[model samples]
Target: MVAMTAAVGARPARAAPSAARLRAWGRGAVGAVILVAIILQAGAAPFVRGLAAVSVPSVVAALLLTAAATAAAAWRWRILAGRLGLALTWPQAVSAYYRSQFLNTVLPGGVVGDVHRAVSHGRSVSQVAQASRAVVAERTAGQVVQIGLAVMVLVALGMSAYAPAVGIVLLAVVVACAGVVVAAAVSTRARDVVHRELDAVRTAFGTVGTVAKVVVASLVVVAGHVATFVVACLAVGVDAPPQRLAAVALIAVLAASIPFNIGGWGPREGAAAWAFTSAGLGAATGLAASTAFGVLAMIAVAPGAAVAAASAFHRRRATRAAAVEESS
Candidate 1:
């Protein structure tokens, strides 16, 4: 009876990991399919062309823009964390953001870095749940604002002359996301968790100043991304109208926000190809631009690698010190 009970208890634990792996595999497969489809549609030469187009000056410019955006994102994260009673200094937040970006860029699913950030920060502050809530609220707000900005740009740029299919798809996605939120809110099992998340959200939006600050920070982050995309476009020799390029870039950015990506590939390149083709910029141009952007992004997060290494070194040193103290 004891052995049977132990086996039964372990069954749920094993099942949970199996289901998690399946979901992760499904996400990776979706990203792979999208990437493969883009390759089939546009051929592989554009990717090669895109990588060869990056210049020293363009990389420098992208690095600066990425830094600015990362700073603003970190500020926004700090605000959310602060509202939730988690003290996060700007420097600390920026370091963490860089680490998070590096992980997101190199890891599958594009969000493992964020999970690490939340859990790490939570442990640091001894409030894992609130830290998680802060990260979730900050990321959710950023995505919603980003999607809204993308739609506005497409419409404002007179996209009636071209297809706005990407914008429509984003809108549908937003609706679907809203439905998921509602379902979670109404879930009996997740009631307490949902309520706690709501409390974080409520605190974040409790003041007009807080709301305005978040919007400004989010806008800066969005603008930096859009500008970096334009730089990528120029590097790839696509001299389209700045206004139209901004719209297309925003759409690509929206697609990059998709969590199904392999590291940071797949959906972004596919969407850029689609949107650029829709706008008569040629699928090749779009793919090349996105490829350059991806390279620049990885370069931009190089500091994160340094941060991770330094952090590990410090941790080891501290552990050694503690062990020595105990021995003495």
Candidate 2:
């Protein structure tokens, strides 16, 4: 009677939805909202004119720069993964990085990409959490470098008028981020909080030499990404000085960190529009530049979809083969 009652009362656990599936739903929702907003904005003539002004050479340059930025990013991540004591070869790291990029684009949560990369590189959940720590370290260092560059450019170009506000905000953000990293480093309890579920960050401080290499490489990658955004601005004929472009890049990149907006579509474009418009540029030009960057990103990430497909297929085939062998 006890066994029967227990069996009747206990419900079987339902399988949870995959991170990839959740990401797909999120991307679809974001795309739908953006489409609806575009329809409502419906100022057709200006949008058409702005898009038409996207020059061919400028587009080409934007594409090339984006590719370079992507490559640099892959290199940066590979270096970081090595520091975390992952045994990824150079090619493996680059491939995994690009694959993660595709996941990040289509998946709702940005960390979904990191999760996939962590598993692919053979990290245990705890190890993956440690690895995530390394990734955060790399990102924090890059943000600091970016803010410093923006401030320096603003000072050099006599754009000190906008400095106090933007500079203070940037500094505050950097300090907050630094505080978080420092706290994590000192807090074993915090490390345990994100344990198996975020384990890539656990082994985060194992090798100081490797960690330093990752920090430097990450800086170069982030700088390259910012430069590409600046080039995109030039492509759209924005005459703003370099400082302004840097500021715009910082705003756009920061916006992309938000989880809700499919690669930060609405927020990114809105930020660009506001930034450029404040500098006395037309919204149309800002939109064009932002749109160009978006399109380039879509194209650049297309290959990632193929990589993901292949990876899935290979994994499935391996599973089937193992099952067949076991049966035999």
Candidate 3:
């Protein structure tokens, strides 16, 4: 019986990597499809135009805005981590956040960097699960704030113009989320995990002051992103009113959050094109703005490259030291 159990466990252990590989391949395929669709619909002219429009000043502004956003995000993470007993300092969180942003911008799955940050932090504290939950909470809080702001902008700009389509999309999302909740509630083990995560969330965000601070920080991050998008539009000579740009920009921001993207390329451009066209702006203009935004965003996260390089060098040094100690 002991041998049989051991064999059974070994089968899953061998299969795990294969399963992970399959999932990664699937995500890549989806991203490729989305990118292809965008190219076919929008053509490649806007991308070139966006690149041409980039200037030193615009890039500098993007970098500064990105830094501010990253700082705000790191601050929020620090608070959540502290509540979860993870002991992350502000500087550490900012560095990790920068590295994660760079990884997400360049990696196949836009979330790889975030996953790395969570796992690395968790390992350090030996509270892998809690650490992971902190990331989830931080990200979830940001998304909630973004969505709320988007809704407000949409409503203020008269939702009737975009209501039918946006409402349908939102309805589908709500239904899908409800289904997941029901499924989790029905599964005993899943329910336990959900309860634990919820408890962590409550502990981290339960206090009014903490909740307020998180919301404010998230708002700052969102505002920085929106400002960057506006800058991108201006660089590309969109020449639209701030309100109109803000509305379309918010929509594009929401679309970018969708997971199907080739290094954050596909859905964002498509959504931008759609949003701009719906708002009576040229689709090409939307594409140009989206392209510029993408470039500027990549530039803004350039610091992450330094952080990642330093991290790799440190790890190599540690490994060499460990090898020497082992030999001795």
True-structure RMSD, every candidate: 6.2, 8.5, 5.6
lDDT of 2 by residue, 198-276 (tens): 3444454356776566566656666656666676677667787676777777655554544445653565566566566
Q: Which stretches of candidate 2 lie over 4 Å from their true place?
A: 1-60, 109-111, 123-127, 155-212, 240-243
Ranking by TM-score: 3, 1, 2
Error of 3 at 170 (Å): 3.3
Task: Give lDDT tens digits, candidate 1, residues 145-248.
Answer: 88777767677887864345565656666786586578677897456655655676798778988888898899999999889998999999997888888878
TM-scores for every predicted model: 0.87, 0.71, 0.91
83: Cα error in model 2, Å: 2.6
List the global CA lDDT of all models.
Answer: 0.79, 0.58, 0.79
Per-candidate clashes, comma-separated:
0, 21, 0
Off by over 4 Å in 1: 1-26, 161-187, 319-328
Model 1: how far is 59 from its true place, Å? 0.4
